[model samples]
Target: MMTCLCDAFFDDVARATHEVLESLGIEVIVPESQTCCGQPAFNGGDWASARQVIRHTLNVFQGDCPIIVPSGSCAAMSFHGALLAHEKETDLPQVQAFGARTWEICDFLRNGLGIESWEGRLDARVAIHSSCHSRGTGTPEAIRTLVGSIAGVTLLDFTQPEQCCGFGGTFSVTFPHISGSMGRLKIDSVRATHPDLLVSGDMSCLMHLNGLAEKQGSPLPVKHAIQVLRDARVTPVTVQ
Candidate 1:
C-alpha cells in the first residue's frame, strides 16, 4: 500500500518507482484500494477526518506485504504519529499494527530489500534536500545511501541541507509570506551548492523550490530522488 495527498502525485511517483523496482527484478503489488494517508487532515488539526482516512487505509492494506509509501509525510503519519493521535479510538490496535509495517519507499529499497546499486548515471554534482518529514521518519539516510549508489554522481553536503522548504501543504496557503520567505532561504542554500540538480523525496517541496527558482531564473533544476535513480541511464543535461 502507498498513499499521498492526491492521485496525480502518487501515480507519477508510483510509476517511477515501479519502473525502478521492475528494472531490479523486484516485484511490487500496488493495492488499488489505498487512499490518502490523511496527513493533510492530520496536519490541518482535523483529527476525526484523519482517523477516518487512516481507518480506511488500514482496512485496505492489512495483508502480509509491507506498506510502502513514496511520500515521507504520508509514511510518517501512518508509521509514527497517526496511532498516537487515535490511541483512544476503539481501533487503536489495528492502527498501531498497520503503522508498524509502514516503510518509506527509499527505506524499503535501501534497507528492507537491500538494493545497493542503480543502472543509470547523471555524471554531475548534485545536492539533496532532506525533507523534514523524511528526516522525522528516519529515512533521510536511506535516501542519501540510494543517491550515493548512482555512478558518476556526487552528493554535496550543502549548508542547511535538512531545513524545511516551508511548503507544508495547506501551511503554504495559510501563511504565504512566511512560506515564500522560507522557500527563498532554501533556494539560497541550493544555489550556494552550485549543483547541477536539486533532489528531494517530497514532490510538494520540490515543486515549491522549483517555482521559486524559476521565478528568480535560477539555473538549478529540481527532481524527485526516484526520477534521478530511474533515469540513471541517461546523462542529465547541464543547465545554462
Candidate 2:
C-alpha cells in the first residue's frame, strides 16, 4: 500500500517500493481508488470517523491477493485498526480476512519471498528504527536480517533501537513539546552510533527524526529500507 505519508511526502520511497517489487517479478496492481488507511483518525481516537475511512478502504482494495504495505503503522492499521473500527459488525469477518492478506514490505520480502540476504552491496553504516507500530509484525527481524545481509552494509548498534521517533500520527501535533523531546532523544541515541544513514520501514518516523536532526543542526541522512535495497541492487556502471 502506498501510504498517505509516502504518497504526499516521500514519492521516491513509493517509486522505490514499486521498482523493487516489480524487479522481483511480482505483478503489482495499484488500485487508483486506494486512499489513506484511516490511521490518523484511528490514532486520534476517533473510531467513528476511522471506521468510515477504513470501510471505504476495505471496499477499494478488494482482492484476495497480498496487500503489500510499506509502512508498518498503516499495515498494522489495516488488520488491527480496522478491526477496532469495525468491531462487532458483520464486516468484521471481511476485515479479518483483509488483515490476513496484509504484509509489510520487509516482512513480505523476508518471509513471503524467502529472501534471506541481499547479494548487492551498499557501503554504509546503517541504524534501523523499528517503528512503534512494527511490534508483533515480524518487521524488526526482517529489517535486521535484510540490511545485515547486504555486502559492505554494517548495521550499527544504537541505544533504544526499539524506541518510537515520536510521530504517532496525530500524537505529534497533539503534544509537540513531548514529540520534539522524544524525537531529540531518538536522534541523540542514533547520533551516538555515528550511523551513515538512518533506515526505517516507516517514512513517518524518518520524517520526524530527519526534521528534528536538521533543526538541531546535525542533519541525519535517512532512507526507507526499500530505497536502500533498490540502490544496493543496482549495479554501479563502470565509467572507464
Candidate 3:
C-alpha cells in the first residue's frame, strides 16, 4: 500500500504517483483509514500519543505487503517510531515487522522493482534537494540513478547538495525566522546552478523552499521526485 501524506493534499504533488506505479504494472493501494505517522508527536516528546497513532496505523495497514511512503520523513517516522515508542518487548515484535516491510517510495521504485528503463521523458534540467531522512536512508543516491534513466532530463550539481532545507517538522514552526532563513540559504544554493526545477523525496522541504522563493519574488519551481518520475506530460498511449 502507498502512504500519501497529507502534505500532498494542497498542490497534489503526488497527483500522479499512483498512476506511475500502476503504469509499471504494480498494484497500488492506499487505505483511507490511515492518518499521520505521529512524527510530530514523537519529535515533540510525546511518545504516548505517537504510540497510539502508530498502533492505529499498524491496524490500518495490516498485511505482509510492504508499506510504501512518499515522504522520507513520514517513512522514517514509522520505521523508527515503531521501536522508539513501544515500551514493552511484546509490542516490539509487531512494530518491528511493520518497519521491516516499510519502503520509501523512491527506494521501492529504484530498488524494489529493479526498474531499468522508463517510457516517460522530460527535457528540463533538474536539481535535487536532499531531505535529512532521505540522506539517512541513502535514498538520494538511488534517486540520482533513477533520474539519470530519464531520456532528456539533466540533473544539475551545486555546492552543498546534502544540506538540509531547515523544515525539520516542528522545528520550523517553533523557529520560523531561523527556518525561513535556512530555507532562503538552501534556495540560494539551489539557484546558484539555475536549474529549471527542483526535486526532492519529501514535500515538506519542497514546500518550504518553494514558499521562500515565492516570498522573495523568485521563480523556483519545486517537484516531488515521484511526480517527476511519473512524467505525466508523456504522450498518451493510443488504443485501438
Candidate 4:
C-alpha cells in the first residue's frame, strides 16, 4: 500500500518499493480505488468515520492476494486496527481474513519472499529507526536482517533504537510540545552514532525527524530502507 505520507511527501519511497518488489519478480497489483486505511480517524477516537473509511478500503482490497504495505503503521491499521473497529459487528470475519493477508513490505520481503540476503552494495555507516507501530510486527528484525545483508552497509549502534520519532499520526499535533521533545531525544541518539545516513521503515517518522533535524541545524541525511536497497543495485558514476 502507498501510504498517505509516502504518496503526499515521499513518492520516491513508494517508487523505490515498487522497483525493488518487481526486481524480486513479484507482480504488484495496486487498486486505483484504494485510499486511506482509516488510521487518522481511528487513532483520533472517531469510530464512525473510521469504519466508513475502513469499509471502503476493505472493498477496494478484496481477494486473497497479500496486501503489502510500505508503512507498518498503515499495515497494522488495515488489519489490527480494522478488526478493532469492527469488533462487535458481523463483519469481523472479513476483517480477520484481511488481517491474515496483510504485511508490511519489509516483513513481506524477508519472511514472505524468503529473501535472507540482498546481494546489492552500498558502502555507508547506516543507523536504523524502526517505526513505533512496527513493534511486535517483526518489521524491526526484518529491517535489521535485510539492511545487514547488503554487502557494504555497516549498521551503526545508537542509544534508544526503539524510541518513537514522536509522529503518532494525530498525537504530534495534539501535543506538539511533548512530541517535539521526544523527537529531539531520538535525533540526539542518532547523531551520537555519527552515521552517514538515517534509515527507517516509515516515512512519517523520517518526515518528523527531518523537520526537527533541520530546525536544530544538524540536518542528518535520511531515506526509507527500500530506497537504500533499490539504490544499492546501481553503480555510481563519478564525474571526472
Candidate 5:
C-alpha cells in the first residue's frame, strides 16, 4: 500500500516517523502542502477557522493511500475534527472520506500491519508521556505495546501516567498559569524516574514538557516514540 505521510511539523516528530516507516520498508510519501489540522483553532472553540484548516488538509490528501500521521493530536484532528468541523452539511462527505484514509503512525504500524513485536536493541531506560488524546483513544497502550517489543529498552511508568501535560494547543496560550503548573507536575513525575529519555506520540506534548524540563535543568531528553523504535532497528557494526 502506498502511504502518504501526514507530517505535522511539530519539531522532529515528522522526521522520526518517516525514518520508522522506511525502516519497516513501508512506502511513504509526505504531502508537501500538509499543515496543521487546525487543532489549536478547533480546541480553542473556533470551528470556522478549523474548517478552513481541515479543508486544506483534506485537499492535500485526496487519494486512496493510507494517510499516516506522526502526531496523535493531528491524527485525532484528521479522524474527528474534519468531519464535524464544518458548518455546511455538504462538507461532511468529503471530510469524512479524508478521515477514513487517515491513521496515526503507531496505529498504522501495529494494527494495520499486525506487527505484534519488533526486533532491536536499546539499553536506555525511558518514560512515555502520553498526549491527552491517548488517555481516551488508547494510544498510550498501543505505544507501550510496541515499545515493550524492543529487546533492551526499559519502559518506566511514571506517576500520574494518564494525566495531561496541559498543552491543549491554544489552551496553553489562553491559560498560561494552569498550563505551566500542569506541565511542571508532568515533568516532575518523569524526572523522578531519572530515565535517559521521555517519549510520546505527540510532539506538542514533548515540546511543552521538554521546555519545562530544560528550565528545571533536568538532564533527560524528550523525543517521539518513533525515534526510539527507529533507532532500535539498527544493528551497529563494530569497528573492523
Candidate 6:
C-alpha cells in the first residue's frame, strides 16, 4: 500500500520500495486497488474531502500485509491524520483500523521487520534530508539506522535537517514566494553538507530540492533512500 500525492513520482517510489523488499527476500503484496492517502486534502485543511479519500483508500487495501508507504507524508496521513479524522467522525471505524496498519518504508524496515543492517555499499558521501512528515511520525532515527546499514557510505548530518522543503502539495502553488524561499533555504542546507548524494524518504521534498539544485547548477545528486539502497544491492560486486 504505497500512496503518493504526486502521481508522476509514485510508481518510481513504489518500484524502489518493491525492489528493496525483493532484494531482502521479503514478499510484498500490493493491492491492485489502493489509491492516494489523501495528504493533499488533509494538509490543505479539507478534512471532508480527505476523509472521503481515506475511506476509499482504506476500503481498497482492506486486509493488508502491514500497509507500507514510500512517502512519509502519505504514511503520516494514513497512520495519524486519517485516524484523527476517523476519531472525529462516527462513520469511519474501518479507516481507524486501516490506519493502525500503516507504516512508512523505513519504519516498516526498522520496526516491522527489525532490519538492523543491509547487505550492500554505496561507497560515496550522502546527506539525508529528514522530511517534516518523517520527523512528525518519529521515523528519522529509523532512516538513519537504515542508511547506516549500507557499507562504505558516509551519511553526513545537515544542520536543520528537518526543515520543510515547502512542497506541501498546494503550498507551493498557494504561496509561491514563501515556498520558493523555503525551498532555497533547504537547498542551501543541502549544499552546505556538500554531499555527493542528497537522499530523503519523501519524493515531493526531493523533487522540490532537486529542481532548485538543478536550477542552481549544484553538482549534488538527489535520490530516494530506497533507490540508493537498491543501487548498492544491484551494483556488481568486485573481488580483489
Q: How well is each residue in 61-149 modelled by candidate 2, as lDDT tens digits?
A: 89899999998888899878888888878889989999889999999999889999976878888899898898988888898899889
Give lDDT: candidate 6, residue 194: 76
Candidate 6 regions exceeding 4 Å error are: 136-138, 236-240
Residue range 139-185, candidate 3, lDDT tens digits: 77767878667777788997887677988888999999999888888
* Number of the candidate with higher lDDT, 4 or 6: 4
Q: For residues 88-121, what per-residue lDDT tens digits would candidate 5 score against the true structure?
A: 6677988888778877778788888778887777
In candidate 1, residue 128 scores what lDDT? 86
Question: Could you give me the TM-score of model 2 versus the true structure?
Answer: 0.96
Residues 65-143, model 1: lDDT tens digits = 7777776777788876788778788888888888889887788888888876665567778888888877655578878
Instruction: Give a tens-digit lDDT track for model 6, residues 1-240.
Output: 766543555577788889888877888887777668887888899988988888888778877568778878788888778888778688667776787888888888888888878777777777888888776565777777887778887888877866788888899899999998999998887788778888888888888777776788864477777777677788833221
Clashing pairs in 2: 1-68
User: lDDT of candidate 3 vs native?
Assistant: 0.76
TM-score of 4: 0.95
Q: In candidate 2, residue 163 scores what lDDT?
A: 73
Show the colliding residue pairs in model 5.
none
**Candidate 4 lDDT, tens digit per residue, 2-65?**
8888778898988888888898888888788887889999999999899998888889889989
Which portions of model 5 show Cα errors greater than 4 Å?
A: 1-11, 235-240
Per-model RMSD to reference: 2.3, 2.3, 3.7, 2.0, 3.7, 2.7
Roughly what TM-score does model 6 have, to 2 decimal places?
0.91
Give each model's whole-structure lDDT.
Answer: 0.77, 0.87, 0.76, 0.86, 0.75, 0.78
Q: What is the model-wide C-alpha lDDT for candidate 1?
A: 0.77
Q: By the TM-score metric, which is better: model 1 or model 2?
A: 2
Q: What's the distance in Å from true for residue 80, model 3?
A: 2.1
User: Residue 142, candidate 5: how far off, in angstroms?
Assistant: 1.8
How big is the positional error of residue 74 in model 2, measured in Å on the Cα after superposition? 0.6
The candidate with the higher TM-score, 2 or 6, is 2
Write down the TM-score of every candidate: 0.90, 0.96, 0.91, 0.95, 0.89, 0.91
Clashing pairs in 4: none
Q: Give me the displacement of residue 83 in model 6, in angstroms.
A: 1.9
